[model samples]
Target: MKPCPVLSIALALALGLPVPARAQSAPGQGGPTVIRARDDALYRELGGQEAIRRFTDDFYDRMLKDARIAHFFDGINAAYLKGALADYFCVSAGGPCDYDGVSMHNAHAGLGITKGDFDALVEDLQQAMDAAGLPFATQNRLLARLAFHHRDIVTR
Candidate 1:
């Protein structure tokens, strides 16, 4: 499979390329893990926990309606999953969140997800971030960390 664009774009932005202003990981079991972060700059840019929660909700809504990947969540609980996703994103963005959820590798172990599914999900996230008023760079920052999980999530 081709590499996810999120990683490269995030690296470019981190390396000094500009991202247009817009609106919007880790591995293993742990008490609380933060993805390769030095600070909470992304958390701040994301407008904190409340905002994160909002976008996560929006993301799930989009995902549930998307035919390409909707089946993946067939037996899942929407409310609970949305909250978990919020916490996950919060932690991923370097916020003060204690995400005690399942690891990406474990959570998706038998899901049989594909590159298309992953990309569609990422697109849903961008839509959510856009709706939440996250700037381009902020979206990329969060995506950069989350994209690292592509290896863990895409099992197909």
Candidate 2:
């Protein structure tokens, strides 16, 4: 079998992918983010699932090392998160992948996540995208799709 990746939305918020594992999370309790993709264009630009997996791998490393947000991932199974996150991103990018993780709201409930944390997470994601060699316009396009998820990740 192919090697799977680590954690997500912070895994994606970084895509707020910093939720508990499927066994521990609410398991698809919340609604999905509806992104109007122009027919897999974004997915292709993102280099497909392989590219996403690489970006996610780097993204998780960044989050775990960042003092500003690493605490949130304590004891979490990053491998499991990475798979779910890739699917979320694939779906967001218009690929034919199924997102089976919990809702953004459900994933981050009671985490006391603040706007600052969300921003930090997004920053890390941007850096990861940059490292992944994603073009400026392409990165912006993807980020725009994920922007709405902020409300769910950074609950007051």
Which candidate has the top score in lDDT?
1
Which parts of model 2 have CA positions greater than 4 angstroms off?
A: 1-28, 33-38
lDDT of 1 by residue, 96-153 (tens): 8777677777778889998878878888888888878777667777777776566778
Question: Would you estimate the TM-scores of all the predictions?
Answer: 0.80, 0.78
Q: Which regions of candidate 1 fall more than 4 Å away from where they truly are?
A: 1-36
lDDT value for candidate 1? Answer: 0.73
lDDT against the true structure, per candidate, is 0.73, 0.71
- Model 2's alpha-carbon lDDT is 0.71
List of clashing residue pairs for candidate 1: 22-134, 22-135, 22-136, 23-133, 23-134, 24-134
| Superposition-based RMSD of candidate 1 using all C-alpha atoms, in angstroms | 6.7
